[model samples]
Target chain A: MAERVLVKGTEAIGEAAIRAGCRLFFGYPITPQNELPEYMSKRMPEVGGTFLQTESEVATINMVYGAACTGTRVMTSTSSPGFSLMQEGISYMACAQLPAVLVNVVRGGPGLGDIQPSQGDYWQATKGGGHGDYKLIVLAPSTVQEAVDLTVLAFDLADKYRTPVVIIADGVIGQMMEPVTFPEFRNLNTLPKHDDWALTGANGREKHIVVSFDIDPHVLEKMNLEIVEKLRKIEANEKRWEEYKLEDAEIVITAFGTVGRIAKSVVEQARKEGIKAGLFRPITLWPFPYERLEEISKGKKLILDVEMNMGQMLEDVKLAVKDHARIEFYGRMGGVVPTPDEIFEALKKFLNV
Target chain B: MLMGQILSLAGMFEGKHVTWMPSYGPEMRGGTANCTVVVSDEEVASPVTSQAEVIVAMNIPSLLKFEKAVTPGGYLFINQSVVDREPTRIDINIVKVPCNDIADALGNLKVANMVMLGAVVEKTKVVSLDSIFMALEKKLTGGKASLIEVNKEAIKKGMEAAK
Candidate 1:
């Protein structure tokens, strides 16, 4: 293992992005995620990278969109409300096929709410936040270490697909500190250059126009169909989830992000009590892994969806399980995270224990 | 902000896996601000946790808020200078120390958290005093270079009081 350092998730993710060869960052201050840009502000200049805090979230996203069109591994971070401000820019990036990382360290409520962790942005993240039929490659990391790893993956996945990637994490994961050993510093030296589409002064090559607006109806439909096809391929290959003791479990618990981490403890307690409870953690929130859930659902008595929001991801769990087993949901919202005891009580009610 | 960092460093320096979360509560200072640290032998799952085996409450609200969350037979080290409410839980052990007094005696009330930290290290034996001292030296020098000695003295006073 590499050398372990105790770091907050915000600090770790920023350093991981630096190691992942992301140099240019544009961000606006938002609660629960401000430390991220703080880290970048200190580290980016040291590494000859650009870290600019724009006047507003709208400016940050548009600046990121402009930087990303130049094939720069760029990023912008915000909480729910700030992310809402970036929706138009996000849609433009999706249309322009720009590779950039966006992090939504979600806080509570539908408006300017509390700075506590909440998973209410599930719909905004997974279901095209902007005004378009587009999807972002969203990865939900549970722990601080996973935040680092998934951030590295998010950048790579974004570049590989030539689209934006979202690291949809809650405030808990964003603010938490943990021992993390980053992978050997993958410097920008070893990465592939995106010179083909990159606007590098043409360099004696043909001119490139990075445009999201093609007025022809047929051409726009083709672009939308192409995005649909990419998402289809992604859904097929990138559905990632973890199953714990699903073989003998009669009740399967489904959760993601912080709720999933808390559910692991509940699963451990339920197992010790011989309750035959298991856990399924969705790592990729956008792909919404269901193939394994389908296999686990065959013999399970029930699927309990635990979320910090009120049954946001539960709809997907039902769509995946699809009448094979009864689906139940228990959630705590508005920044009130449930404890293991609370989850266990919910489990008992669902499992009739 | 640095409480969880020092604890996690001490834990990692002891060759253990540790995870922590610091509350950036909107209240900011003097308003129930605290952090949670979990040190274990193996990789810890999830940063979201409810219970603590040992809670070092430096303020009254923290003591009141986190006292019940401590496990049965767990330790609750409170700064008796600010917190006077006797913990209602009988199963847990409470070590109420005059943290502000000791830090003030040592000539720096700002090291009150360090005092409580030293007490936690001595009582829980979760991390060595040497590790914490090393962490303090690093943390102290990284920012305010002048308060290092008084904080160390505060920790020494705390170690003595913890006994």
Candidate 2:
């Protein structure tokens, strides 16, 4: 049986990471997520784990890279501006195929915009915040409970795919308190073995090197192709989403993260008003869940895309619908949240309820 | 209903849709702030309550900031001891009560929110007291078990005052 307790989002992430067998954490304190490192600092030593409050995000990401290379489960976290600083390291981790978990409790930004919650980084996360042909399996959690749940899932997926995973939550979800149940930490022996590719001194087998290099043009192309194939498989197998009232929805709202939660409440309220509004929330953002959206939009009157950013994910919605359904967008920028009333008004216009 | 964000869960007003869209701005740092909770029987698309039907301002700043945002025929419940304001809007009903003073009498300052919540419920009767109590219990459990009694008492006081 699970016991419920009020948990802050940042602390939940730290606790979940520890329970997931993550032994190393390197992070910098940034607003909206300061509690994560602080929690880790107070708790990691007690569990015989290493928690380092690094000098900067750049240093922190590199520390994650080093720890991950040593075959240790490791993680780090930051907000928007700090996330920007860590991009180069993230890109390197992606290219090197390093499996690590990265948490971005996103705050407003475009250049130190503010320390408030914002989803403006949608494109940055989905389109590879760092660079190159890479993708960070982004999970946008709408609540403190999901924040913990997603952090645990992030480590598992990161290890399985040998890629960095990002848990993108806004300040609202990061700082809020909610009752949540954490699964008991499992024995390390039950987890999948990573000895196949993890660097463990080769253990008298053979010499091993951890690098993202291939001087030969054909070899590099082959490596790139292999990565693409893996991503394609992930897209095919890991597209998880939640559908509410979509089977007969006239106006469907596509949202992720906090906006999705507000959209959900609006759907219920709209239903009482006799408008068939539904919510389609993506659990795995990187995979995009386009196919399911395409299937749901077959007979819908309109698809409303709600986000915290101005219009980052709006493009994806339009692309998925492809003129098959009338599409519109609603959003807030710089950490301002979209209210259910505002969303309801928008839905009424589209559905004519 | 189980999207699991503590602030977005079921409210005291059963059959009413209520959501809290938290301000990610300066108010988040213990500064005076407000959230829009819409208690609607019909479906609501937008959750932002720019102009509230009723507002309970616990501090001077909350009063100053939200005074203009009340609907033309809405009500503004103020703790007279905490906020002193000349009635400027004739269309809106303004009820001034010494809520902070009552909370002081109740032996806790934090019950101010519960008191205001009670007054809002009694004046508007939008949400049921039992439901609010349930939500409050969920919200204030764990390290806060000691204050629940005082908060429950404060809510009772506000309900009686409103009646």
Which residue pairs show backbone clashes in model 1?
A: none
Tell me the tens digit of each residue's lDDT in model 2 across A166-188: 99988777766555779788577
Please, what are the lDDT tens digits per residue for candidate 1 over residues B42-147? 7676555678888888777787788888988999898899987787888998898899988888767788887887788779888887888777776666468787
Q: Sum up the clashes in candidate 2.
A: 18
**Fnat for the candidates in order:** 0.71, 0.25
| CA lDDT, every model vs. true structure | 0.85, 0.78
DockQ, in order, for the candidates? 0.67, 0.24
lDDT tens per residue, model 2, B1-163: 1112222333412544444444444565677666655556654434455678887677788788888988999999887767776657789988776788778888887666666666767787666667666666676678986767787788888877767
Query: What's model 2's lDDT at A282?
Result: 89
TM-score of chain B of each: 0.92, 0.85
TM-score of 1: 0.96
